[model samples]
Target: MKKWAILVAVMLLAINFSFSNGAGEAEAGGKEVVLVYDGDAFFSLISTSLAFHEGKVPMLLFKDDLAVQQKFIDDYGADGLIVVGRHVDAALPCREFLGDAVAVSLKIAEFFGKSSSVVVMPCSMDEYNLSLIATPIACYTDAPILLYDDNDDEIISAIDKLGAENVIGIGSVAIGNVHLKSEEEIYDYISDIRDVGYLAVTNPDDALKPEVTESQEMSFERHMKNIQITILSQKINLVGSDEATFSISVPDGISRIRAIVDVP
Candidate 1:
């Protein structure tokens, strides 16, 4: 008889500074700078993307390394900084927004002015995957994505302040004028406005740690079968294998992965 053990890993890809589109054009006091939370402040992370996009500012991670932050400031010639989350001893003239996730998100939305629509997702940690999906849509649609708690009234007030004509809810949440109940529905809705593709690939244990080439390319054909679709007049193929393996490349980085496989 063959014995089988299944191992699963879910990787939560941290939103890094490299994701920013560079610094925004300078304003009156100085150039607009990106504000980042030093910790796993999920709501702040989602809200900041909208703020940065609307403001057209560059973003950097706020870790214990003040020197790195200072270098970013000097390199960009930034005179003022907008600090998100808790207060920090910034190296430049800065404005801080401090509060819980809901408060912080409301502040960000208020700072950027108003929006015509709002995207609301569950605030609990378990619903992070939904937030991840909703984020890009919010940014692209120029809408604010707020984390909603069933008991929380502040979200309602925040929506009122935004004067949003449309409210979009992800999952089974009670809010939103329109609710997207599943991943496929969310993807389909966004696809109408933009091209979207999702791929999940699994590999055997030995194949997980491929050689870290300068190009950082992994041969998908070796591990998985191909799935294809057409969006916006473009063709996209998603490939995945039956075997499951998981690993993380960054030290001290947060990742979540889920894998299911049969083994002996």
Candidate 2:
């Protein structure tokens, strides 16, 4: 290849990389297999790698669109996409919250199938959504999901009475009071939860290294364990004993990302 031709190719490659990673003359890697979650599901969804503070709700909302989600599939050659949802309401437009979520789930199932994989975590309607309606909220939603309840005893008892096989618990419901402190403090919280025969699913705040309970180390004032966890019932038999495996999907190129969505 001519030197000039090679130079042109390099320049074009740089431009493409900039275009995909960011706007304004950024370049994207052609062979990098950059998975873009081009779906609306990620719009407001939060990740755990962020610093928590007041007014940081955007860090934890499920607002991605379809286009982005599909792109991720194409780019990664991903085998499966589990459409896990944060929080959903029971009553609402049949097509809006739970309705749309179910639709997304179906689309994923149909598109990926046994080949690649696409599925949604249909919402659950439990007490937390109800509590939000009774109190103040950052935003309004009709997604179907259960609430964390924030109390450890309530969650464990729920699993025991309801049977762990029938359901899985999410979020800091395991950490309890210690969550208000620092990441190191969270250990005691986790210990407390485990003692009760419950599990604590990891999120951005806890997943990220040096988990800072306060928003920032210096400004160590305002912080939030204020997020919620949502769940869906499995085909679990109420008579069987089982534990739900909890995990969060991190954005491409981001490590240790953790964040929870609306609870219950």
Candidate 3:
């Protein structure tokens, strides 16, 4: 089955939620950064930023990685949240990575307006850690969805056309089922602003292994630049926040490039 097995556990206890009614003023116009993660590591990252700058904690749940962070904000339209990722990926899922910033900004009014908001670094991510969000994307009620995976060109093109018609079209390739398009064609195809997705990466070594030729990387970046929509990737950083830098150790050989939504 392409779908992952998600273990859902509800916190009946007064789960240490971050929303503090008395913590700070609404500051109606101030930019509020959302730290999306489920454990101490991500919380600590949010705390570190608080050390240098003041912030308002979001009441929403989150993961330590930027990918998941973006996913939550995009779907539910929260104040903002963090994302997660593995350090070993060769090609970073740009759509999922970009979700952290875009989702929060679009949902949070202050961020959408002209303001100097730096989304704050997405909670530092790690491996396939359990994030708070293990739910499926059910964003739109009436939109038709087309499921595709690696090498399903026929289905992908169909989605593009449907989306162009302003139809609520969703792709199930966030599970890494869809194949990567050729470098040049990907740019033109995914550049449209109406696209959205849930992303996943089943092959970490292929995505993170550092062996891309300069030409290849350029093609990859070119494809990424054209992606204005959101996507998903696996290896979520679901660790919640604490009072330090949300830190996660990537297995040896992962890329050193930093991931997640940026607020710093």
Candidate 4:
């Protein structure tokens, strides 16, 4: 009889373990992944929104009561929980991933099955205008926005481990070796830098990299050829467009090897 009791206890433990690991499949199957943030705080909301843009998940304002938070998660059928803010505690049945806005974004990106290319924005809400600028950029790039601080060693290491190819810095702040693509001077800089590329437009679109079309008026000349161009570094390929003209500027005795290229 004792042996049977022991066997039943073992089976129960196994079942609990299964539920813990597969909570999404067991309870929230076919539901959208959800992000839980401390809604009372504006900074938390905005920072968490960065991840939401990438995760494409609904946001659930976290309640102090664990039961209330659990119900909210159940109501939405959240496959995963990304808890934002340092103080917010999640006691959900599923896996509870915790981090500040920037750190959480890395987890959210993995949830969406995207490569970890992230946009670095200012950490404080005082730079709200800068954050506003970064939002569309993040959406277009399909990357999470990480708040920047010089001492953010953990965030820096996380980004490195992600094998991130393009780490874009928005606004005036410089994080790491990121070049400011928002300025006009980047055009000249592009030519000088070996692997640098430029994307210019009379009217910029919501796309991180805009599409280039052929321009019949602007034909490629012989001297204007073979200049290497790319979009977001290497994410997209570009070619010359008849709609766009490639003009080369070289000093005396220097050859104009290529005219210009358009991003495809």
Best by TM-score: 1
Q: Specify the poorest-scoring 10-residue window by lDDT in model 4.
A: 3-12
| Model 4 Cα lDDT, one tens digit per residue, 1-264 | 000000000000001211133335444343433335564233343444344343445445655644566665666545544444434444443444466555555554444444446666666555544454345344445565566655477557656765677876655557646655453322232334343122223223222233343323344544333344566776432544324445644557542233455544
What TM-score does each of the candidates earn?
0.59, 0.22, 0.19, 0.44
lDDT of 4 at 234: 62
Writing each residue's lDDT as its tens digit, candidate 1 over 1-264 gives 211111112122222222211233323343646566767546444544555353546666676545667776677776666666666675455666668776677776675567888888777766665565555567556777677767458778888888988888887678878898765666666666543233223343312233333333232223456677779997676665344455536435324333343343
Per-residue lDDT of candidate 3, residues 176-264 (tens digit):
22232222222222333243333333443422234533221111111111213224743333343222344445656655544543443
RMSD versus native structure for model 3: 22.9
In terms of TM-score, how similar is model 2 to the real structure? 0.22
Tens digits of lDDT, candidate 2, 1-264: 101000000000111111211123323232221111223332112111010111111111223544434453444432221223333221111111122433333332222212211111113332222221211111111111223423345433433332223232222333222122233332332333322322223233323434333321121232233333335743534442333334434447544433444332
lDDT for position 146 in model 2: 26
Worst 10 residues of 3 by lDDT: 216-225
Q: How many pairs of residues collide in each model? A: 8, 52, 50, 10
For model 2, what is the C-alpha lDDT against the true structure? 0.24
The CA lDDT at 224 in model 1 is 52
Off by over 4 Å in 1: 1-30, 194-264
Look at candidate 1 and tell me the lDDT of residue 185. Answer: 67
RMSD in Å for all candidates = 19.1, 24.7, 22.9, 21.8
Clashing pairs in 1: 9-257, 9-258, 10-256, 10-257, 11-255, 11-256, 11-257, 12-256
Which sequence of candidate numbers ranks them by TM-score, best first? 1, 4, 2, 3
